[model samples]
Target chain A: MDFKELDPILHSQLRLAVVSLLISVREAEFTFLKEKTNSTAGNLSVQINKLKDAGYIEVTKQFSKNYPQTICKITKKGIESFEDYVKALQSYMNPGGN
Target chain B: MQPVYCFINRLFKPKFQSMQSENFSPKDSLLLIDSMINQAKNRFTENGFLYLLWGWLIFISAVSHFILLKTRLLKHPEMIWMSCWVAIIFQIIYLVRKNKKEKVKTYSDGIIDNIWMCFGICMMVLIIIVSRNNLWIYMYPFTLMIYGIPTFLSGVTMQFTPLKIGGISCWALAILSTITLPIYYLLLLAAAVLIAWIIPGYLLRKKFKNQH
Candidate 1:
């Protein structure tokens, strides 16, 4: 049986979790994501930068009440990639096209 | 024995190969997606501040207007509604602060915000139409009907049963107002605010506290 390749960018656990959260909410702040994913600031920052580099998400930084805030939003390309990844996973589960 | 081990390894090799290096199999990935979506969905909880604010404001105005009219204590019972302008200024300040403090903006939030904004604009236009046409006698029923729109839509968007019930209550009260005397219209308006805003507002506050 032939298998579809998953998007390498979304294959990792943390990255997938971030995309999944962003997909539903559309926009979230850095603190919100870090809290929800239960990830360290350092690690989440890295994964977020990677996603940004892949054009899967956009990050915005600004000051809110004298404190820095980082907001992230998923782009069209990211949404398409996420949809494709899910379809590929479905094919793996049902190789016979059931 | 060696051949049996090799056969078993060969059978599992493809499955292991299909899994991510982090040991997340297809099933695990799907589960993660489901969970994260739920987490994001549940993260939004309404504090019900605005609902209670408007609800109490309308409720007090209606009741007080009815009392002033019945007692002939005031020449202009309608003047009570002017207090709403003051509340409007307060609402603006509150919203600005709330928006500043908000860390995220969900699609549902955006839709609900627009629904209320539309409701506000509609109410303003309605007041203008009624005043210009001298249709104040028919105002209560019409106002109640308008109240139902946003209340119902917000309930559906948030999946909150109380707000849905409140919306239905507003419509029922509107129908009842049409059959009653014009003098009693203020009471019906009071009832609408109590049901549609106050009760749901309190319940929403409780839910927000519990969730937070």
Candidate 2:
């Protein structure tokens, strides 16, 4: 897949932030992502839904300690896309994939 | 006993709630929370470093055993076992270091992982220095299986396919090693442990370090 084509999705800072955090953690609760991104619940939820629609992440809703919890996990496709996005970004920055 | 109260009441909530929202923005709250998390992460990193040190202590001891195997000291198997105990002492120190770093203590998989590795180390050492009969041969496969279980679990917990694959490979090799116990099985056992545990241990240590 040509990652340059994914520039629009990858260019959004909030979406990029979501992917980066997910990469490290493998999975995170919605509250955790909300706090980390420092974005409003509405905005964060919207972006997460977008990523989910894109097949980049899977959202699982569950209960923890009687509290509703939403968990997000990046898929293999997401990982591949993120790597490609990183390469594209690097090329844009350095004019070389290196 | 109530550490939460100490943090909320004694530390910040009084001054925080007293101040006007105009004076203190949510950005300030974010900064405070970030600092708190950073400190927590630093503590975790230190604990991970201590764990890595424990693994390294065992690695060094194993290497020492290799060297000692060739020398006249080979005659003194009890002395070598004593040295392994010394390594165990260092491992205890590592455990202490890890325990001190984490406050909200519960037995997580990391504790289980270390405990399993410790068992494997002890059994492997006994097989080398004490057990002379054919029954000792089982220790080779047993240690391999013990070492692989935690590795596999950690991989599943973290959702990493490569690590999961590595763990399965160790299990498969352990079985194969058990079956293929021909001449020089001791050397083969060493090679298997190194591949199964040591290499993955190093990779895990490195991965844990980077995650921090």
Off by over 4 Å in 1: B1-21
Number of the top DockQ candidate: 1
What C-alpha lDDT do the candidate models reach, one value each?
A: 0.87, 0.56
Candidate 2 TM-score on chain B:
0.54
Worst 10 residues of 1 chain A by lDDT: A1-10
| Candidate 1 to native Cα RMSD, angstroms | 4.3
Which RMSD does model 2 reach against the true structure? 15.7
What is the C-alpha lDDT profile of model 2 across B1-212, one tens digit per residue? 13322322343344445333213222333344345344333332222343344345544554555566655477653254366577668778766655443222222345555655775667667676636665655655665666567656655654545446656866776778756843333454455445545565566667767755
DockQ of each candidate relative to the true complex: 0.55, 0.02
Q: State which candidate has the highest lDDT.
A: 1
B1-212 per-residue lDDT for model 1 (tens digits): 34433443354456547443444566678899999999998875589999999999999999999999889999988899999999999999998888767777899999999999999999999989999999988788999999999999999999999999999999999999867999888899889989999999999999989888
